[model samples]
Target: MGSGLPRSIRFDERVSERLTSYVARHPGWSGSSAANRFVDEALRMEDHPGVIFRDGPADRRAVLVGGPDVREVIRSVKSARASEPDLDAGMVVSLVSTNAGVPARLIDTAIRYWAAYPDEIDVWIDEVESFEEQSLLAWERRQDLLAR
Candidate 1:
């Protein structure tokens, strides 16, 4: 107690109040610990910037919308409810219709795929690709039939 060393910083009244709420929300974890962990992770990300957003290829159709980037979209999908199939459907519809500049009905199959696989957009893309391939094949068959 008689050592002349500096002491640790103490939480002020305002910080203490916020910490109390945080502690209540996350049981078994202290407010300071939570704050420290979040700050540490944020600082680590700053040190090594990951793919929060990347420039699309020169030939790719990429447009930033709603002031929210891909990372925010990913976060939103993660935090959304497990039973939110309709919400995921709407998201898929919006993305496909917006990107393809086609009617939503054309991308209904993609929406259904996304609804089934809410956490993964890869499956939805596969479904869209299959739909495109089938349409092209059908068009080619029709062209042959017309020439016959």
Candidate 2:
């Protein structure tokens, strides 16, 4: 008997082993579940993507806020960063205003919210097979009493 599903893809042994390891690491998961989760995440990432720059000039905020002097915000952010390496929305807004020539205040507000509320993404499908086993055992006991 077959599920009658067409098999267009194949998984290599190495990939299968890695997926099994991932399932073992995660609580309440199986190897097949891990494989499905990985594919789903990969497809989602491909659908929406951003560019990764290498040593490019910063200023991502100008697009968000309209400003006459974008460079000023960039300068402010750069100056602030000199004292602090760890950056927040304020620094990014300043840089964007400088590069994109947007309003500093508008970008600043947007950045604050974006920084404060980040998205958490997790994927898994779980089933309680143990409960099914218990139910089957109870049903067999009831049938045994009825047979008498």
Candidate 3:
């Protein structure tokens, strides 16, 4: 569509209805443009460890394949390594899956993404750690206030 080449395509009634609905829900999007965008985005996501991007609350985007958020899986792996420095990928998968209720395959998908995008995952991990530290400090302060 972006190549300035025009191509004609046909869709069934159900598919056409869905396209119309999607355009209606997404302001400033036309049916053809939405279809093209979704097709291109899906193709791009297919190459990246089976991960799919989805919109969540407050219009925030999340990377997900099947189970928990990719960040959540990475956080679990980091937490596990804190206790067992020799933990391997398979062990991390087992531990994260057991604790997070996500399947091993999805955990592997998250790990694959992490391998491909270590910098991005590291940023997420840092944010999580910072939040945890803040929460712990707040809890300690509350405890001190109650004991005073």
Q: Could you list the CA RMSD of all candidates, in the order they appear?
A: 18.5, 21.2, 5.1
How close is every model to the real structure, measured as TM-score? 0.27, 0.31, 0.61
Which is superior by TM-score, 2 or 3?
Answer: 3
Best-performing candidate as measured by lDDT: 3
Put down candidate 2 lDDT per residue, 1-148, tens digits, no spaces: 1133444557798987777787788678765555565555455334322211121233121222233222233344545567567777566656666665666665554333333322310000011235557889999999998995
Better-scoring candidate (TM-score), 1 or 2: 2
- Those runs of model 2 whose alpha carbons end farther than 4 Å from true positions after fitting are 1-9, 51-148
- Which residue pairs clash in candidate 3? none
Which window of ten consecutive residues has the lowest lDDT sum in model 1?
57-66
lDDT of 3: 0.77
List the global CA lDDT of all models. Answer: 0.48, 0.46, 0.77
| Segments in model 1 whose C-alpha atoms lie over 4 Å from true places | 1-7, 41-148
- Tens-digit per-residue lDDT, 1-148, candidate 3: 3554567879999999999998999888778788787776577477665687677652323376667667778888888878777888688779888988988888888877787778867886787689889999999999999994
Model 3 regions lying over 4 Å from their true place: 1-44, 56-62
